[model samples]
Target: MTKKNVDDYLQEGMYGTRLPKEAERKHFLGTLRERVILALTIGEVMSDRGLEKLETEMKKHPNSTLLMNGSVAYKFLKQERDLADKYKISHTTISNQEHQTEIGAVLTYDHAIDKEDIYLSNDEDQEKSDSVEKDDQKDQGIVERIKSWFS
Candidate 1:
């Protein structure tokens, strides 16, 4: 038996999958529109706030698929555009590069949170030292009283 080639498969109507029907496409677009609207509303509210605010607003939506959809993603792009307009800044100032940087920063923060060790490095040992100092200060009065009683 001979194996069918790409051209043979195309000729047999088995290469590429069929496109969605018109009604299905329309329904998909309608869902996209709704997701975009929701994302836009969240983005607008979060424009002046940080990622924590954005995440909080996005959580309210509760539709994970909407978060991954391109139409909904465009809402964030549009948000930066709107912010640029409000500030009278050029659209180029809020380019895809900026968006990518923001995404990177957010992902880094998420990764840090997911890590078992909370401290990034031994540099955080300063917090431990500070706590020890506070305890020493609290015990200083007791130490003085003991010394006075013995004297």
Candidate 2:
């Protein structure tokens, strides 16, 4: 008989349990770094207890810089939900503002500053140096000839 795969094993002769939703999966895979940063930023609004809980939740993830945006969004949403429930405020307000701020931070951090600006500046300096060297060479030839005659 053919070997069964993981899906077959999971199904056990019936359809496997429904897979996690896309958003759920994304949220589940969010990075610790993003979560910590989010917590710190939000701590400005949340209580020490809330911040502690958030930090505890973040500790469950591996410490690394490679956090995914979807996961970060998921963590933010979760925190916002918790804070809203705790403080009796509209979750939408915090979520919307945090979403905007997070989006801006992610865009800024992910983009690398181009080195072409420094490179172009250095090239200009090099051209100037080359021109000075040529001028010095021309001056040296005539000056050297005069010195030789005087000697």
Candidate 3:
């Protein structure tokens, strides 16, 4: 390989190597969206709402890195770090002084996997809603039965 010249070194020092999809990387917490396997919101991380989903993704991508937003309180992110440890995945906390993202955590691969969806599935949320509907139906059934007896 040819040695880099003084001018080349100076230019590189003046401006860091260009990264592709920089805006997407900034929004996704230092990783490209396509490389991400899963991303969690700050509220979800704090409440442990997406913990299971995160863990499951970690299990699936054991070689992936877990990148947590350092702006969030460590207590909220510690659980995720522990989960990463369980899966033997390396984890890092990203804190950019110039940019901050609402994303609480990201499970990412080094290379572009171009995953279509990186957010947790809402199946649990869907199940909860279904349960609520069932409860409402049960209440309606009891009321109808009482009305029939009174008639």
Summarize candidate 2's per-residue lDDT along 37-119 as a digit string, tens digits.
Answer: 33222222232333443333334322312222332345444643454345443222222322323221110112233322211
TM-score of each: 0.22, 0.24, 0.73
Find the number of clashing residue pairs for candidate 1: 0
Model 1 TM-score on a 0 to 1 scale = 0.22
Q: For candidate 2, which ten residues in a row score worst on lDDT?
A: 102-111
Instruction: Give the candidate number with the greatest TM-score.
Output: 3
**Consecutive 10-residue window with the lowest summed lDDT within model 3:** 116-125
Give lDDT: candidate 2, residue 102. Answer: 27
lDDT (CA) per prediction = 0.36, 0.38, 0.87
TM-score winner between 1 and 2, please give it.
Answer: 2
Q: Please give the lDDT score for candidate 2.
A: 0.38
Candidate 2 stretches with Cα past 4 Å from truth are 1-117
